[model samples]
Target: MKTVSFLTKKLGFGLIWLLLGLGLFSCEPDPIEIDLPAHEPKLVIATQVFPAKYMVVQVSKSFSSLAGDGKEMNADTTFLKTLAVEHALVQINFNGQTETLKHVRNGFYVSRNIPQHFQQRYTLTVRDSVSGLECTAATEMLAPVNFEKLEPEVKRTEKDTTVTLHFTLADPGPERNFFLISLVGANRKNLLPKNKIGSFNAVQEQIILVNHGAFTNGKYEGKERLTLETSDTLLVSLSNISEPYYNYLQLYQKSGSLMNQLTGEPINLPTNIQNGYGFFSAHNPTAQVFKISER
Candidate 1:
């Protein structure tokens, strides 16, 4: 009787183990197949015109984010050379005159004859002979806004030094307007060693955009703070930008996320170009240089 009882318990345990193994084997997952659409490359145009400066247009081709190993896209020389649209017919038209832009180097087109006048409309036309693609865009040059007053105050501590900038500018008029404020700091000649102070050899630039209709009192006042060496030179610039270009820039900055690119999600950035995928705009910047003084 004892032997029979033991055998019965052993058989019950064996049955349970067999059922568990079968259940595990039956729960295996099946592979799923997804159908992704083919992607076609497009022409990307980037051009910013300033008064009295030659208009340089950068033309390049956009590729699928999944083309190479999943890495962030870098605009290095090799990458630019690989994706540059070369030998393209680029032209700019303004005031009943059309000027052809010369292709300087890898995807860059230049035009020195196009007059950049305030409120004058300029049209850009680009045709790629190799790809049989054509695109066009139009933009008006915006006038520069002068700064009313720019004052800097410095505060130094044992750890770091901070400079506070106070600035003001008059509004153009009741008409809607957008502005971009830029600050650049460069090392002065014969300054202290770069190691003792922070490296100021490379120009550090900070830019901020003022939204349209942000000011109502016909005047704009703002303040910015920075950390820099005592002998650094600072350049402050105020630029009046068009509404469309401002929108484009705002969207462009948002869409520059690495995760967004890696996911292959489509983002339609605001573009003035017809049948293309970039922006063409013009602005004149009023700038002033200042020498940093100890306080």
Candidate 2:
């Protein structure tokens, strides 16, 4: 009598069948599907640059769940169309020291001689002339980031150029937070460095931040490495700090509402944007020279 073995003829046949199935699976193309929900708009009230910049809040009319849709609608025409529907204004009261506000193109107020500092207490009073609503929240500019080193980094590739920034603070849990980075002209002479780059007098070049970077940690103990292509110096300030109790962007943007690009959900930004100083070094170096101070 033949004894049945684990790898007997019958079992061998079964294994061969299984191997054939796995082979088919390997040969088959992986199922690839794209899923993106509808994208709500981000109410963006922005200024070109200070000292003669136009201030306007823009609301995106449409957004896609993925980059394709977002990229398609992010053209100049769509942005201009969005700006046509909103208004914005920023009023400041430094310890009840009233300052005259003027509305520029986007309802943002600018004065010829107004300065901001972390030491100076300030309150922002905004009036939505279009909706007849007002956002008058108050917060002084917290002391700017005290970076260990803020100079530019040059490497083999232009993209390797860097600005090492570090600060002292504990992490805000593990949930990630988003930060908006921008590089604006430090002076009037250095406007629009892209079209005519490499041939201009720049006191400090701006990196021209067009988007945001989301990170999991909050505090930078010593320094962090940021890689990019820049040709100017910058005054760097980062915000949109989602702490345990404070949501900055949600506090602002009343009309169009803030949309989560990831979730495609709408949020009424409390302050919308806690405007301080120095955004990211967009793509250049000397966007804004951020001066770090200490207590």
Return the top candidate by TM-score. Answer: 1
What does the lDDT come to for candidate 1?
Answer: 0.68
lDDT per residue for candidate 2 within 164-271, as digits (tens), equals 444333333454533333333232223344556332222223221211223224444433333323324345544332231133322221112122221223332333
Worst lDDT run of 10 residues, candidate 2, spans 277-286
Provide TM-scores for the models.
Answer: 0.73, 0.40
Each model's lDDT = 0.68, 0.35
Assess the local accuracy of residue 111 in candidate 1 as a C-alpha lDDT between 0 and 100: 79
Instruction: Note the residue pairs that clash in candidate 1.
Output: none
